[model samples]
Structure formats: structure tokens, C-alpha cells
Target: MRSRGCAEFSIPCPVDLRKYLSESEKCGICNLTSNYICRFSMKKNEPFEETLGKTAAQMSSQKENRNCLKGPLVLDFLFAVLPYSAAKKLFDKKFSIPVVSFTNLGVLDWRRLDFGNGKINDAYLATAVKHPPSFQVSVSTFGGRCALCSSLYATEKNRRVAERFLDGMIQELESAVSPSSHKAPAKSQNNAGGGSSAQRQPAGQQEGSDSKGERADARDKGKSKSKPKRKKTVHQK
Candidate 1:
């Protein structure tokens, strides 16, 4: 089968991207290639040292880089590249954290460097050509595919894990764009009930109409009292 980029560059659905970046999105491009980046802030109440240590441990564990780096910084770096969907998948599957080191470039390094020199060379070339500080993983293609499962799917358990990751990633995208926002309104099951729009009224206007009626009634009552028909005085002339 033909490779991913060479054969055809399928555009990723925006919903899928949303599943990847939940709250915010940041993308950096170089040489016409782009990579998304996002950052999440730390809780303010914790001491710097405590927060730092916890973050360091998490990043080292998640990214699988042993060197002690500050948590917020590590999170920022991760936030930029690994979407919540991918990050959640990696954690759920118990895969080692992947690091982004420019020297290593666009290569997916999961602690042990099992991928050979040629693969490494290809990874480096891909990164250099693309110039995004992060690596992109595609389920279907090599290099672009998962680093852990590409080989581990020999057993049923591993296959299940792989499927979960792929499925979760897709679900993430699907959930990102709300159905109401992206999809056309469907024919209602209760079409006789006058469809979706008929059942709901705008809250502000609904209240305004009631208030207006009350004001008009008050005005009518005041006018009736103030202009009580002057007793048609039988002219006593």
C-alpha cells in the first residue's frame, strides 16, 4: 500500500482536532508544515516546590524523560503537542511518555530507542522538513503511527489496547464539535408536536411579553380612573 503523505494527504476532521485540543489551540508552522500547541495552568494554592516536584514527576513519568523538569513547564510543552485525547490514550494504555527534543527532532522516542538508525534518520528528516517541535501519530501509517502498539499488537490484549487508543482518539474528535453546531437539525420523532424549534421559546422574549401585558393593564386601569367619564351633566342652564 502507498504511504500516507506520498499517496494522499487526508485532511484531519476539525472535530478530531477538537477532541485533541479541548479548551484552546495553538499551532506553529515552518516550511509550510504545522504542529498544534496548547498549555494548561497549575493550581495557585500549592507551594512552588511542591507543585514543581509533582509536575516534574508527572512529566518524567508521562513524557518518560527522567531528567527532573518543572511540572508546569513540562505540562506546557505537552499541552502544546499531545492533545488531551492522545494524552489520555497514552496514559490509559500505560505507554511510556514520549519526549520532544529538537536534536531527536520529529522522532517518537519512548525511552528505549528500539527503532533502528534508518528509521531514526527518516524521523529526523521528517521533523526537519516539517519543523514542528512535536511529533504527530497516525493510526494507519508508519512513523506517523503509534510507537508502542506498532509492534506490541501481537497478542489479543495488545490488540485491544491499540483499538482502544484509536477509538478513543476518534471519539475525542467526534465529541469536540457539538452535534448542534456541526449537524443539520433532524426531523423530529414528534413532528406532530410541531418540531424542535416550536417546543422552545427564547427565554428573554417570553418573559418580556408577560411584563408588557401587566404594564398595559396597569395603564388602562389608570386611564379609566383619571378620565372617569365626566358625568354627562344634564345642562342645568
Candidate 2:
């Protein structure tokens, strides 16, 4: 978001309420999700640790207070007591969906995903494609390796922006996990031929981790020297 001149933003994170509701068992026919909005404000050149701490605190507080359940409960009541059309209309009028969203699908079971025909090299969660100005990013882990996928309204311009944004995200993640002594220099965002392309790091090469995983690489020849102005809000849902 900082790359897009967004300093303040709110992102809604889907919360799984099954554990809270004592419905932990998997049920293919049921939906057990709710959401809590995470609001963030970034200071100029603020350390990433501060941002991460704030996000963790906010999410923890919301979950402890059971705030995520309110939306689903209200919707359930409205549909149960009112006519279908009336309920739908009322809900639509009262709620406004955010333009940007984020979700973490958690770790996928490799054993279950196996088809017994061949080994799966990689897997990631893809979000639904949305209209213009709306975007979503989803995260998943497979075999101790993290992956990120994003969906948005596509145009030549928008696609380029999204690719750059994802590339920035990957760089941030890699820096966070890498040792300070071996940290690489920041790369320029305006580099030619840059895109959100995954590059697999050798096993035990990244921070001494044993897992071999893919990371987005946006090759660059220079460094970014300027900070962008705060101009937009990133709404995540």
C-alpha cells in the first residue's frame, strides 16, 4: 500500500468462528466465517516491526471481544425474521463492501491434495477476480513454504500496479525473515521487466531454513530513493 501512496488503510480479515461456536468438525455444507476490519496507519519510513505489532494487537483484541461474530449473527437474524427480498435489500443498503481484502487460508494438507499420479511442485490460493478499484490478496502455506496470490480488475495499467505491489510484499517478507548480516539492499520499484515472478531459493539458503520455497523476484538495477505521499486508503476485506 505504501507503494501506491496509501498510508492509512483498513482491511477486513475473515475469521473462522467454528472454534468459538464449538463447531470445530469439518462440515462441507456449512459456512462458518465472519470478518473483522484491521485499520493501519503507517508513518514515513516507519519500521516494519511497529506495523506488525499494531496489526497483531488489533486482531487479538477483536477476537477476544468476539467482535467478528456480530456481522453473521445480525445477518442470520434479519433473514430469519424478515422476508427474503426485504432482508436482502436492507442488508445491501446498510453494509458497504471494502474495495481491498486480505485472507490467510492457513496451511494446506499436502497428503490430501496429492492425486497419487505425481508430486505437486507448488500450490497457492487464488482470490476471486473483482471489478475495477477492487482487489484481494490471499495467503497459504504448503510444506512450510508461504505463497501469496492476488486478484483484481485487470487492465494493462492495473495489472502492472498489482504486479509491483506483490513484488514489494514479497521483498518485505524476505527481509523480515533473513539475518541482518546478510540482508540485501533495497531494489528500485521502477526497474524494467519487473513482475511478480516466483523464484525458488535453494534449501537451507534462506536464514538457515531447511525448506526450499518460492519467493517473488522483481529484479532491479537501482534503488528507490524517494517516499510516496499518502493519497489513498487501502480497504481490505
Candidate 3:
């Protein structure tokens, strides 16, 4: 860009780069088009920290469902990528979006996502090296913990740098959710479903009685141990 006498500049809108494709798609109720992607620029800046803060706060507070970062970002990619990639054939110019993409799949229910064989161990995101974005970040929360996963396409010369960048992000997040700063969860909501102490009184009393029996059995064993063994004189015959 500096060689072109500009502080920042973009390459000749890579035209005909993706010419072997269609411009529209129809899937059930979704009718996707390529018109919007032709002039799209993925360089738009979104304050990640602010977005993360709001989402985290809501989740921690036990708020309702949040169709969060993953839904919008991934759905947009699903609807747009193909059409945009095919734009080179339809028009003379192909569009650009963020070189670096980020998506947060907030707190998923693994039990529901399971497919009977077993539960999902983990989930991840990735990108193509031939694609514009060289780096991407994907986040998800599960088992009361957060996973910050990243993907990067890099050559030997830049692989270390990419690793460092990703490591830095993970370290920062770990610091944010440090154990010392973490708060204990409030009383379980399960207790509200007629499972409170009053409702459990009978069970508790039975358990207390069981414990008393156990104590009595223990006392009997002690008494048996305390009794001196009867000595039998050996008969000469």
C-alpha cells in the first residue's frame, strides 16, 4: 500500500478469482442472493470486548436464550460466502469481508447435541488457506467452562507469530475468569420444585434413624471387643 503512495490500500478487487459458481441459492425458506456481497467489505470493526462483556454478563446472570455471536456471524457466512465467491463470474468484482473472523458459540447443551453414540467432546472452527482471512477465533462455553480456540494459516516464517498472538488472547481470557475473582453460584433452582428442606423432612429423619442404628451396631462391636476371651484349659488326654 505504501508503495502505491497510500498509507493503506487494497489490491485490485480480485476479479474472476471465483468465476466457477452461481449467484443465488434457494433452501426451503431462505433465498440467498449475491447482489449484496459484490460490494461488501469485511473490514468493518466491531468492538469484541463490548460484545463479549454483554454476552458474558447475561449468561452469568442466568438470562434467557441468546442468539449470540455464532448464529449471526456463521449464518451470514453460510448465506454469503458461496454467492460472494461466485461474484467474480456474475460481475467484474468480488467482495471482501473481515480477514480475521471471530465467533462465540455461547454455552451449548452437550446433552441435547449428543447423537446417542456418546456426547460431543468438543467443537471447533477453521478456515481455508486460499481464503482471504488468515486467522480466525472461535469460542464456546460448556461444562461451566469456556474454550477459546483459534485457527490460522501460516507459513514456517509466520507460524510462531500466529501462535503467540493466539496464546496471548487465551492468556488474557484466563486472567479475566481467574478462580480468585469467580463468584459462587446462588442456591440451586432445583430446590424450588417442592424439594426444599421441609419437603425432605421425612427422608432426613429416616436417615437420622439409620445413623443411630449404625452407631448402636458400632457400640455392640466395641463391647464384644472389650470382653475378655474365655481361657480353656487343655485336657492332657
For each of the candidates, give the backbone clash count.
Answer: 9, 4, 3
TM-score of each: 0.19, 0.69, 0.36
**Model 1 misplaced stretches (Cα beyond 4 Å):** 1-153, 180-237
Local distance difference test scores for all models: 0.28, 0.59, 0.34
Superposed Cα deviation of residue 173, candidate 2 (Å): 1.6
Ranking by lDDT: 2, 3, 1
lDDT of 1 at 221: 43
Model 2 lDDT, residue 129, Cα:
68
After superposing candidate 2, which stretches have Cα over 4 Å from the reference?
1-8, 20-32, 179-237
Candidate 1 lDDT tens digits, 2-119: 1111222122110122223435553633222222221224454433344436434544453443222233345556657999987667555752323232121233442334445421
Q: Say which prediction, candidate 1 or candidate 2, comes out ahead on TM-score.
A: 2
Candidate 1 versus truth, CA RMSD in Å, comes to 28.9
Candidate 3: stretches off by over 4 Å:
1-94, 125-133, 179-237
What TM-score number comes out for model 1? 0.19
By TM-score, highest first, what's the ranking?
2, 3, 1
Writing each residue's lDDT as its tens digit, candidate 2 over 1-237 gives 443434676779877777775445656557577788888787766666677788888888777787777788899999999999999999999976777788888877767777989456455566666767877777787644556666555565775566557656665654555424132235543221222224322123322322332222222226452221111111222
Residue 18 lDDT in candidate 2: 76
